[model samples]
Target: MFTRILTSALFAGAAAGLIAALLQLVFVQPVLLHAELYEGGELVHFGGDSTVPAEQDLGGLSPVRDGLSIVFTMMIYSGYALILVPLMALAQERGARIGARTGLIWGLCGFIVVHFAPGFTLAPEVPGVAAADVGLRQVWWFATVLAAAVALWLVAFGRGWAAWGPAVVLLAAPHLVGAPEPEVFTGPVPTEIGALFAARAFGVGMAAWVMLGGFAGHFWARETAGRDAAAQPA
Candidate 1:
């Protein structure tokens, strides 16, 4: 069982890392670049030189940032899997069955509870970097949560709650203890642009989380099956 859990976690972590990389390249990077351009305009508005590089670029966060991002992404996924595997194992021990659809719902529900719940809030923006103001972003957060809930409910075949409960608790525990305040980073960018950056960050982070859950759940199921098979053999 330990071996199976470890194997599943490794696979899920790798998948999460890969997805994070893709998201960073395809979605996050482009959004940041656009925000940078917007900030340049704002700088010019203030009669400051528009040539200053964006905080993301100027932070000298090149390859190191990329590596750290991947590491963190993997850690989040693996941690989730670790939290969930025991619950799943218990369910299996009790003869509960979970399908792919069920897992998807669980993933989505977990996403909503963790990301949209009022108990958890965004951290402060770093100095000199335009990022979203912490807390919910008006109606968008509500709307997005609603849409995602419906989508996940459908995809998870309505079993999301059962499969995701333990994982959700695990994820939220730290937040319940209190997350660090958002850092107040000064930026050459306008507040609007900072808000946009914050939104994008949330989107990307959530997307990665859901993808992580899905992959982890799938592999966990596989691991359980293998364990059961081994136990049944002569």
Candidate 2:
């Protein structure tokens, strides 16, 4: 059981993470680097002297930095898969079908739970964006993620209003309490760039999560089947 979970999670997570890292580099990094320029006073929003570079340095193509990024991304997705595969197994035990298609739905739910849910309150930030106290925000973020995770699980597996009623409350409770806010909204990054970064980040997250779920489902099913077959008369 341990081996199955580890292998499935690692394979699925690594594959998904690799792709996600590439996508983030292509679609998200430029916006981030641009935002940093503003944050660092290298670029001014309205100053006549400031001109957008034809191409941003993008960290000078540092292999070490980029390589570490890929590895870190893989680790993160692998961690997510570690959580997801066990859940998949549990779901299967409860008669839930596991497959690539189903996994896509699961992936979407995961995205909603982890990214969209917290983001709905906090939104993604760039380098210069003014925000709440870090410790306070971290507390709120963790609570929100936990609440969202429970709500989703209950909604998925629990039966009738008994399960759903609480799910709704759990889902709404955090938002009602609200996330910590800055004393005042302030930041060096352009609103447009921040907005674009948030949008692209969410988009890339959705894609990565869907792929992760599909790969996880595929591998989990295959591993389980193989184990079962090995146990059968032979």
Candidate 3:
């Protein structure tokens, strides 16, 4: 049973991760490159003498980087699938529906857990943006993800308000506590560019997460169906 689930997770995760990497290159990397211009003093904010070097212009789109992106994405999404698929099975056992629809819902829940929940405080960082220490941000981010995931699970699977009320609190706790802030809000990137980066980053993440859930659900359903068939009387 675990083997089947693991196999489904690996397949679905790889597919979703590959798709995500492609989407990130298309949607997110350009902005990231642009932000680098400001960070590296190659392009000034607002208005200035800007002649972006050819090297800087195309630096963000690298074949090697893209390869790494795909590899990292695959590993990350596969890890997520490994965790999610089992929870999905448990949810099904507990009478929740388990299919694409539920999977999509779960995916959205995942986004809320990792992205939106943390985003409320941290937001996405652009290359030129200056903010909080990396270590502090990571600590907060991990805590937020944990809190949000548990909160979502409780609300989704818990029996009643007794469970749900606390879920809401958990969801709010991290935000209420707030994310780590930099000593000063300073960056070379424009407010508009930074804002756009954050929005696009979230958009890309949402897309990837949705795809992850959809694929995982599809594969999981198929594998479980096969198992059920094998167990049935001939």
Question: How do all models score by TM-score?
Answer: 0.58, 0.93, 0.92
Cα deviation at 130, candidate 3, in Å, is 1.6
Q: Which candidate, 2 or 3, has the higher lDDT?
A: 2
Model 2, span 60-126: residue lDDT tens: 5457877898999999999999999999999999999998889998999989888899999899887
Worst 10 residues of 1 by lDDT: 118-127
Query: lDDT score of model 1?
Result: 0.58
Model 1 residue 108 lDDT? 53
Deviating ranges (above 4 Å) for candidate 3 = 46-60
Q: After superposing candidate 1 on the true structure, give the runs of residues whose Cα lies further than 4 Å from its correct spot.
A: 30-61, 118-120, 123-188
Candidate 2's TM-score: 0.93
Better model by TM-score, 1 or 2? 2
Query: Deviation in angstroms for 82 in model 3?
Result: 1.2
Across residues 65-166, which tens digit of lDDT does each residue of candidate 1 receive? Answer: 677867777776677667555655555566656545555655556556446542245432323553455353444344444444444334444366664664
lDDT of each: 0.58, 0.90, 0.85
Those runs of model 2 whose alpha carbons end farther than 4 Å from true positions after fitting are 46-60
